[model samples]
Target: MGAVTRLFELAAGADRLGLAVTRIGLVVVLVWIGGLKVYHYEADGIAPFVANSPVMSFFYADPANYKAHMNPEGAVVPANRAWHEMNRTYPFALGLGSVIVLYGLLIALHPVLPQAATVGSFLVAVMSVVTLSFLVTTPECWVPDRGGPEHGFPLLSGAGRLVVKDAIMAGAALVTMADSAKAFLRRRARRTPAEVPSAGAVAA
Candidate 1:
């Protein structure tokens, strides 16, 4: 095979590995965030996004809160309420986002689902891109330093891990996209008829 063709084949083979890796990551994230939501259900210090914007509230905010605040009970609130809601609902947002991420990964892993892996990689790519914004906006999310004066495992810390993790996923997504495109092109080329020159043209 040509070098380029071999590269495309390698890319095509990456789907299985990428899906497996991404599935594990998604599971870890979901379990972690789900645990967080279970522990931190209260909305204290949260920004009340569900209670403010009508359109934006449905995504990750509590549906009840969204319904409650969508109509408003009395006075008009400030415009920055959305930001506040974002802060207050941060844990919930993470929890819900993790669930969706996990679901996408699961779907990707299912062989019955055609193009599941490619679709999952695309979804993960979107999450990775969004993680960039989250990292920029909340550097504190990358908690550093380990063990302190007590435990001695020196476990890894910080949201910075996510930076590396997501970047890898994005690269995998690119590979999957390339592989899919090549496969599609190859299939189309096979279906197409080979062109034949006219007798007069061949004689020339």
Candidate 2:
């Protein structure tokens, strides 16, 4: 084959590997971030996002007290600790971590259990969309200080940058889902028999 033809062949052959790698990369991200959520600091950092979310705010025991315990100024007082405990942040984080870990594991098992992987991919896609929505729902996504150079509607804060990255994850999940679904259909096709030609037609 010509070099160009050989390159095209190689690219075609790499599709499965590329999908596998994408799945693995997503698994790593989910597990790593989910694991971090189990810690106090990580959970605390996400408090603003969760609190501002109408769908998720109910998870906290005292959503209104989120800022009180955050101690944004780095002052660790009794009130801070009390508010953190009262908010039930740890339990919520743990629950979210558990679900994310499960999703990662399911995606990792795609080779053996593609159906589960498809389900996991679907869940990841949903989660990604929800995370991306934080950019719109959370005021903290944009710089708060009008005096700062970066402060503006178009200028994203650190949290906004983090949320924006979820767009890639959402795209990845969609690709993985499509790949898994194709595999599922192919598997089903193999299990069913194709129709045989009639004897009269074969004679012709």
TM-score top scorer: 2
Clash pairs, model 1 backbone: 46-88, 47-84, 47-85, 47-88, 48-85, 49-85, 142-159
Q: What TM-score against the true fold does each predicted structure earn?
A: 0.41, 0.85
Highest-lDDT candidate: 2
Backbone clashes, each candidate:
7, 0
The segments of candidate 1 whose C-alpha lies over 4 angstroms from its true place after superposition are: 1-123, 144-157, 198-204
For candidate 2, the 10 contiguous residues with the lowest summed lDDT are 68-77
* CA lDDT, every model vs. true structure: 0.50, 0.85
Task: Write one digit per residue (lDDT tens) for candidate 2, span 82-112.
Answer: 7777888878989998899888887877777
Q: Write the per-residue lDDT of candidate 1 for residues 1-204, one digit (tens) a residue.
A: 599999999999997787557555654654454445432332322223233334444555354443333313233444334533644455555565566556455434534433555565566567557654444443233454465553212222343454446666566565654454455566668979999999999999
